[model samples]
Target chain A: MTGDEACAEGALAAGCKFFGGYPITPATEIAEHIAKRLPQVGGVFIQMEDEIAAMASVLGASWAGVKSMTATSGPGFSLMLENIGLGICTETPCVVVNVQRAGPSTGLPTLGAQSDMMQARWGSHGHYEIIALSPSSPQEIFYQTITAFNLSEMYRLPVLIMTDEIIGHMSERVVIPEASEIQLFNRIKPEEKSMPYWPYIPGADGVSPMAVAGEGYRFHITGLTHDEKGYPVMSAEAHVHMVERITEKIKRNISHIIDTEGYYLEDAEIVVVSYGVSSRTSLSAVYEARSMGIKAGLLRLKTVWPFPEAILRTLASRVKGFVTVEINLGQIHLEVQRCVGGNVPTFFVGHAGGTIIPPEHVLSVLKDAF
Target chain B: MSIQSDQSDQQTHPLDDLLRKDRIPHIWCPGCGIGTAFSACLYAIKSSKLDLDHVSMVSGIGCSGRGAGYINLDSFHTTHGRAIPFATGLKLANPDLTVVVFSGDGDLFAIGGNHFIHAARRNMDLTVICVNNLNYGMTGGQVAATTPHLAKTTTTPAGNPETPFNLPLLAYASGATYVARWTILHTRDLTESIGEAIQKKGFSFIEVLAPCPVNYGRRNKLKPLDVLRIYQEKSIIKHFASPSELHLDLEKGITLGKFVDQDKPTWLDMYYKTTRKKS
Candidate 1:
């Protein structure tokens, strides 16, 4: 199956009951598959008029107590930005899949790039933490999408499956485990005995129990800077408390959210960092460079938004230098530079979109880094 | 009449059980009619006799949008211009809930115009009530899609040159199963109409000609009561009026009534039939 199809299958496995999406290149397969399969499972698949409505519908479905998601590419993701912020402020639990294609604006619809890595973090117009996962292949995307949904439900925020067009369109064998083996999470529901629910008050994990519509809580939720009671309170004090709690919830739990795979670094002098489809080539390059006795290692990032800062900071002391490889020109590279903090020199092996960064090019950058 | 019978206590106010009293002294200005429109909605909800637990109200960003937050119902205050689609999701996901979208004209027609037309075209199961104050009330009197052609607004000090949408005609043409128009002066009638809308199947729309006293009224030199009086004097109640004959102009007589009431299969009904056949 293709990565997009695998993603749809993964969502089904994760108990996603609603699929709201627009057909964008590199991501339409996810929608097409869901539109066909969702009905069989008593789920809903709505091809909304546009990506904005798709995203808005997803949030509404989430509030209606259904697990929901939407898939899109660059243009559609741009359109969904405003509502993504709404999801954050209201803390609506849902998933957003961006099968990334090249773009500032329609740069390369049919082709691949990791250009949206930065946008996924800062696309919405506000200060908020985001969870984004990058997958190297169809199999990984399938698993990562399920993981994405789990984290979204646990954190009560939008989680992104940030895969590139190469992986999104590429066909590969994916392992589907029995449904029971795949751990699922439902949003924490308020205790029925607990009346007059304060919907935004954080539990010990800093995630509040959510109330769905028609449950008789008469719960209110809004995108405005709100109080713990979930009513709009436009005061500086309310803004401070609200933003602090949402941001701090993720910040304090970085150990649980950030995921990275290390190829080798115990005795290596150089490391190459990459994500999405670029990580696949980076792994091959690391293996080839090791055969040539270059002592190169691969640090494949699975979670891109949190940026695996602590791990990168620790690795900076061991490795002499780093090569950040991605499709976009120096997006994750800038984060690599920020993490290494000028202790070790960092090199960028990058492309301008519409194509992948070849292994040889990344290998050469690794040599230059050394 | 006894004084005690006439003067009820604050706790005795109707719909108090359905209101968030702590949210009182709402943001609406003294003479703004959004409050009356809001009251009518609650009254209609009560009259409809639907289980309060099975009701959800959704709204976008505007002065009228504030209605959802104050109503003690399962409510969502979503982003600007998004209430209809959001409400669509709610209704579709759980067919048991009575989903309603309450917002202003600018929110429903200007920024969210495509959704309005498409939702109506699909004949989705939802109630959409738009308070048409002829301007963007929350944003302070910017000319709106429903603004009169020669009206003065903060953004149109030179007077609005663009022709406004005739809302009743637009809703009737957009495949709404039930459509009506009224003003705050027609409270009991508006309440009854909303009750009828809630009971109707497919998409139902009500356009309430409301007042934006602080922004629109200050500029036009008309109070909220003045607008209601105008609604009383110049409005003609023409039931099942032709869409072409229902154009509203501030300088001309306003045609008001239930212009469209007919049955049609909704989006979900067709969706289910087709999907089931295919499966």
Candidate 2:
């Protein structure tokens, strides 16, 4: 299956019944495949007016208690930020797939680059925690889509699967797991009904069970600083409680959410940090450096947010230095630097728009680091 | 004596008491038509007899968007200009729930313009109440898509050079099954129109000509009541007016009444029926 077909398959596996999006290069295939496949499976596929409406519709569908998703690229991703924040604030669970192309704005629609890492995290207004995953292969996209949906349902927050253009447009062999083999997570439902349901109320695990509209649960939700009842409460206390609950829900449970893949990091002197398609290149570079007798390894990030900071701190103590590589102008590199806390010297091999860094470029960085 | 009897008859309806009384020293300025429009919504909701629990009121950012928070229903005060799309999702996810979008002209026709047209075109089963105030009152009286040509507003100091949108006409063209327009002053008519729109099965749009006393007042040189009276006098029933003559001019604001209405399969109905047939 192609990467785009894998995403559609992933959505189906994750029980996504609704997809609302407009077509853009690279990401357009995801919409096309889903459009053809969804209706046959009793799902909906709408070609929205623009990326903004696409993102908004997904958010709305999620609140109606259906698993929903939208796919977009650079400009579309930027348009989606405001409503994505609404999803964050409202604790609506949904998935957004950004098949990264080049550009500050429509830079390279058909090309590939992982330039949207930071924007995916902080592009929306105000402060909040987000869950973003990166896929290096078509198979990873299939699995990561399932993970994104599970995390979204678990935390009641929007989860992003940040795929570069290469991976989104790439064709590869992907196994469609039998339904019994794939794990599914449904949003927690209330034990009682007809009583006051606090949509934002955090459980001991920091995630509140979600109740859908028309489920006989009377609920009020607002974009303003709200109380447990979901009504707008203007006060320092209300702000503190609401913000703390949503942010803390994800923060306190970081251990369960954070995921990373390590290669030869057990006794390596230098570690190459990467994610998305760059991770594939980093893997080859690590082998090249190792064959040259340089003690280099790779820390492939699967969960980009709630970033494996603890793992980086542990790696920094053992490794001589960490070299971060991505297709952006040093966004995630800053997070790496902050997490390492100057313990290990950090270096960045970055590009912008739709250009991917060569394996040789990453190998040279590892060679120099050692 | 007949008027008294009519009033008594209206009071006998079940939704007569749901109107918020204390908020009654209403926030809208005196003569502002939003109060009557608000009452019309309340009366419509009351008359539908749908469970308030099954109805969710969603609004975007604007004076009318504030209606979501004020109204006593399962409400969502969402981001600006995205209410219809948001409500579209809400309705599709749970076809059993009644999702209504309440937004101002600026929020619905300008920022939210795409959503409005698409939702109408899709014939999503949702009720959209667009309170067309001519100007962006909440953001300061700026010209909106629905603002009349050469109309004076804060942004259009000399005159609004751009052509104003005819909301009902646009909605009808976009495939809305039920389309209606009413002024705030025509409380009874507006209320009945709203009820009719709600009862319709497919995408329904009611463009209520709400008065903006604070910002639009100084420019239009009319109080809210004046705007209401204009609606009463100018509006002709849809059956009476010719389609070509329906164009309204800002200088001499024209007809206001229910326009296009036809039964069509709603998005949900089509979706479910297709699914069942396949099975």
Model 1 Cα lDDT, one tens digit per residue, A1-370? 9999999999999999899888999899999999999999998898888898999999999999999999999999999999999999999999999999999998889999999999999999979999999999999988998999999999999999899899999999999999889999889999888888989989999999999998999999999999999998889998989999999889988999999999877777898998889999999999999998899988899999887999889999988999999998889999999999999988889878998888999888776664
Q: Can you write out model 1's per-residue Cα lDDT over B1-279, one digit (the tens) per residue?
A: 645563545545788888888898789989899999999999999878899999999999999888899999999999899998888878878889999899999999999998999899999999999999999988879999988887899999999999999887888788999999998888888999999999888999999998888999889898878888889888888999897788575666888889899999999998998999943
Q: After superposition, how far is residue B38 of candidate 1 from its true place, in Å?
A: 0.6
Report every candidate's CA lDDT.
0.91, 0.84
Residues B145-191 of candidate 2: C-alpha lDDT, one tens digit per residue:
98887889988899999998878778888999888777777678889
The superposed Cα distance between candidate 2 and the true structure at residue A265, in angstroms, equals 1.0
**Any runs in candidate 2 off by more than 4 Å, and if so which?**
A353-355, B1-27, B232-240, B247-253, B268-279
**Over 4 Å off, model 1:** B1-10
* Alpha-carbon DockQ of candidate 1: 0.83
lDDT of 2 by residue, A1-370 (tens): 8888899899999999999999888899999999878878778888888888888889888888899999999899999998999999989999999999988777878899888888988899888999999999999999999999999998998899999899988899999999899999998887685366777777779887777777666566778888777767779998888889889999899999999999999988988899988999889999988899999989999999978889998888778999999998898999999989998799998787566789999988887764
